[model samples]
Target: MNKSVFILPVIVILIAAILSSIFIVDEREKVLVLRFGRVVQTIDEPGLNFRIPLMDQVVTYDDRIISIDMAAQEVIPSDDRRLIVDAFARYRIVNLERIRQATGAGGDQAIAIADQRLENILNAETRTVLGEVTSGDILSTDRDALMLRIRNAAIAEASALGIEVIDVRLKRTDLPSQNLERTFERMVSERQREAEDERARGREAATRITALADRTVVELESDASREAQIVQGEADASRNAVFAQAYGQDTEFFEFYRSLEAYREGLATGNARLVMTPPEDFFDYLRSPNGNVAE
Candidate 1:
């Protein structure tokens, strides 16, 4: 029984040691094997790796690019205008041993430490580079050039941490909270001014159209009245010429016709009464067919 117990313990230890000595590095990972707190080997190839059990420590780091988001910061440009700037950076670990040395930590702790340091470097560079340009440039297409400058500056600083800064980008920029209200007020005032100008123009157009319509109406009415008067005058002239021609043809018959027309018009009223005495010639047309006065 004592011999069996010793053999089982030996087997267990061997198994544990075998498992501990073997490490698997993923395709996206880089590993460091450390002996007694000292880096003994750096493995970047993906596959099964072996290390001395109980004597070596394995630290793994991602080999892919990582991103770090920077907090929003206030920047004062050359124009003395303040801007709220938010930025981010993409980077990859270039040197594992250097990163462990720079961070003074191994494994995942080193990545965290490196990211924190890089964020600080990026923030400082963003401020420094943006401060050199005017606000217009920061807010324009020239912003691409400014971001390139920030990335270059960050790369120089990040190299100390064994980080390769691939790119830097300004994500969002806006006026500060206190300035936003004032900007909105200024914009509202401008819109109101434009609206008032448009209304004034509309009123002017309406007035012009109304005046034109009134003048046109007056012109049309005056022309129609003149035409009516001309037609009436022509009709009266033609009537007078007919009367004169009939009078010249026979004066006695013409006089008789005029008397008969006057009588008919005077008697046409509903309740008309004659109040004056008529001359003898007035009845001459009724008394004689030739309209001569009866002697």
Candidate 2:
């Protein structure tokens, strides 16, 4: 009974130690075997991995690309315009050994430190590149070139820490909240000023048109009045010529016609007023039907 008990305990310990020594490395992960907190082996391929059960520690790191979102930071462009820039980066750990040494940490702590360092690098480069350009360029399609510049700069710095900075992108670039309101207000004011200027110009144009029309009306009326006066004078001269011509044809007939005309006019309604003696030559026509003078 004692022998069986001792053998069973030994077998149990052996099985436990064996199981602990063997680890399965997934294809998505990189495994590191660390002895006394020092990396001894780096297994990148997927399969079975072995390590010293109690003396060696295995650490797994993701082999996939990692993303880091930098906090939004403010940058002042060359034109002295301030902008809030939010950027992100894609990076991968190319050399786990170097990353481990550079971060001076292990496991999750190491990843965190590395991420923080990368974020800092990305932010610095983003600010540097964006600061050299105008805000218009940053917001324009040329922003792709600017992002490439930032990525190149960040890659140079991140390579030291075993990080391959694949890309750097500006996610959002905008004016600060406080500046946004002010910019909108300025735009509105400018539009309003432009509208006022247009209205003023329109009013001036309208006034000029009105003045021109008034002057034209006055000239036209003056021309028409002069034409009417000329026509009236011509008619009066033509009537006097006709009367003189008739008088020269027959003096007695002209005198009788003149008498008839005077009587017709004097005897007209609303104007039949006469204050003359009755036996005057004006009665010659009335005294003789044949219009002879009654001497």
Candidate 3:
């Protein structure tokens, strides 16, 4: 009975030790084995890993990419424009030992310190690059290129932490409220000036069109008057030709017709006087009352 009890306790202790010595390393994690606080082995692959029981300790860290958002920082460009920038960075640990040494912290403390250090590096680089570029570059399509340069520079400085900087990006970039208000006022002034210029141009064009229309109307009237005079002159010429032809054909009949026309006009007005001797020419038809003058 004493032997069986002793063996059972020994077996239980072995099982417990075995269970404690073996640990699982997930695919997304990396494990570091420490012997008396000194790093002994690093397991990067996912599987069951073994360590010295009661002497070795395991520390796991995330192997996937991590993100850190930086706070908004203000910077001035070469053009002396003040701007606010918000950015973020993506990074992954490449060498666990180097990262542990650089951070000088453990577990969650390491991650926090690393993230803070990343922001500091990124901010310094962003300020440096922005100071070299114009404000137009910040707002232009070339902003991507500017961000790439910032990321590259930051990566160079931060590589000592054994982390790879995948990318860095600007989240928001704009001027302060005071600058925006001033810009808005300037834009309004420019638009108003342009509107005034456009209205003046419109007035000038309208005046030109009106003056041209008046000139056209006057020209049209002058042309119509000239055409009417030409038609009247032609009719007069035709009538004169017809009268001359008739007179040449019959002189006596023409003389009688002229006398009759003169008498009718002279008599058309009530009791009107001609104050001339009439029987020799105009009165001949009235006095004869027959074909005697013509015959």
Residue range with the least summed lDDT across 10 consecutive positions in model 3: 286-295
Task: Provide the global lDDT of candidate 2 against the true structure.
Answer: 0.87
TM-score of 1: 0.69
lDDT (10s digit) by residue, model 3, range 1-295: 9999899999999999999999999999887788887889988899998988989988877798999999999999999989999999999887788778888665677778889888899999999999899888898765889989999898877788878899999988899888999988999999999999999999999999999999999999999999999999999999989889999999878877777787677779686766766545555566675665632
Tell me each candidate's RMSD, in Å, in order. 5.3, 4.1, 4.2
Residue 217 of model 1: what lDDT? Answer: 100
Distance (Å) between predicted and true CA of 160, model 1? 3.5
Best model per lDDT: 1
Model 2, span 165-253: residue lDDT tens: 99888889999998998889999999999999999999999999999999999999999999999998999999889989998998888
2 or 3: which has the higher lDDT?
A: 2
Which sequence of candidate numbers ranks them by TM-score, best first?
A: 3, 2, 1
Could you give candidate 1's per-residue lDDT for residues 71-98 as a string of tens digits?
9999999998899999889999989888
Q: Given candidate 1, what's the lDDT at residue 74?
A: 99
Candidate 1 vs 2: which has more lDDT: 1
For candidate 2, the per-residue lDDT at 260 reads 90
| Per-structure clash totals for the candidates | 0, 0, 0
Can you tell me which runs of candidate 1 are displaced by over 4 Å? 1-24, 33-41, 50-58, 76-83, 128-153, 166-175, 260-295
